[model samples]
Target: MVLAFLTTFLATRFVTHAIRSGRGPFRDASVGGVHVHHEVYGIFLLLGSGTAEFAYRPGGGWGSLLAVLFGAGAALTLDEFALWLHLEDVYWSREGRSSVDAVLIALVIGVLLLIGANPFDADRSAGEGVVALTLLVNLCAALVAILKGRVVLGVVGVFVPLVAVLAALRLARPTSPWARRRYPAGSRRAARSRQRFPPGRRNRWDALVDLFASVPHGTRPRTATPTEPDPEHTR
Candidate 1:
């Protein structure tokens, strides 16, 4: 499943890059003069695969096939995640960076699970009630982390409870929901948060994002004619 998702993501990015440059034969898919986004196909694939799995409950190779289909569908859908997120085509825009982030998070989590990161498993030495309480506490910490805008940490912390507690105890991002509610204007923590995370500060994560999801304002290799619609603005 991971392999399928990774392959589809790479292929989709390559095709989109080609369309942006008008270099390869790859062009945007359309139907009856209306632009057809790849997510539409992904939605169908997801539905089909899901229905088949539930109804048939196949095993072995059949189950593997369905998983592959589901993974591919997920990749296609997530590639345009920023589009659905903003209810507009944000592809090639700064907002589109979220799509890459989402894909990476999902990929990392999936790999972690495949490699045996099971938070649900409890130690035999610990009582069930203790395990349940611990799980609840970890979940609350995770929620706090997410609200604090430590999204990657919050999500990953679900599989590693210590990370959740650490994230919960940290300062919230200036624009995060937690900060907006708790860190009033001119507050010390608010100022500290801003100071730590200065605006327009390009970090390693930003560089990684730009490497995979370059925006129109960046150094994207494209030179569309004035008469033609800028490919950067299209899917």
Candidate 2:
């Protein structure tokens, strides 16, 4: 219960902080086939955590801990599902191929999480351990996908953390190199490099970093106002 509240409180506060600091919320270009409004996303994550902890039931050995973990995971998965239900426009803007690829990745990982000993259903003592371990694995997988430009893959990678990790990665991953380069200053890329690659990569996040790094900084796309603020504010 406390963890969920803290997480939600911290996440919400962070977004508020970003906005106050002049980093107002912006739309995410990699919406693929689903859209997630940032406001609602935070609400659900906070609620999910609360519900999961409240639903926790004690059990023997690893059973008790697993109960709490599953409840929590359920809360998180519910939050992720909400993203799919609420936002279609942002999720589907990319190439058809990327959307399809993301679904495939989700299916594969979802199956893995559901099967393979079912961490959520483990003995209570082992459940906590299982949840923790799976969370680690999920985090590693998500990081790998983000660096590789697999936006959909990264989004789907959060199953273990009830999609929290995936959400976190989305917020953390650079939206565009141009934006980042400009924000920090002194990090500008040379002009000759900008011409070699397209401005927006297949995924907005990738293109931003890749294009900026490959081409000169001046030629990159200006950070347009986002259509909807990013739901995964942690990134």
The model with the greatest lDDT is 1
Which window of 10 residues has the lowest lDDT sum in candidate 1? 215-224
Off by over 4 Å in 2: 1-102, 113-121, 124-235
lDDT of 2 by residue, 1-235 (tens): 3244234434533443343344666323236434333445544544654565467633474444444444344333432342355444222223212333432344455556546624345465456776788767877766655553445555555544445454434422243443344334333233322332346535564453232123122322324346543443311
Best by TM-score: 1
Distance (Å) between predicted and true CA of 123, model 1? 6.1
Q: Where is model 1 more than 4 Å wrong at Cα?
A: 123-125, 216-233
Please list all clashing residue pairs in model 1, or write none if there are none: none
Backbone clash tally for model 1? 0
Candidate 1 lDDT by residue in tens digits, 26-62? 8777665466888888888899999999999999999
- Compared to the true structure, candidate 2 yields what TM-score? 0.26
Give candidate 2's error at residue 106 in angstroms: 3.4
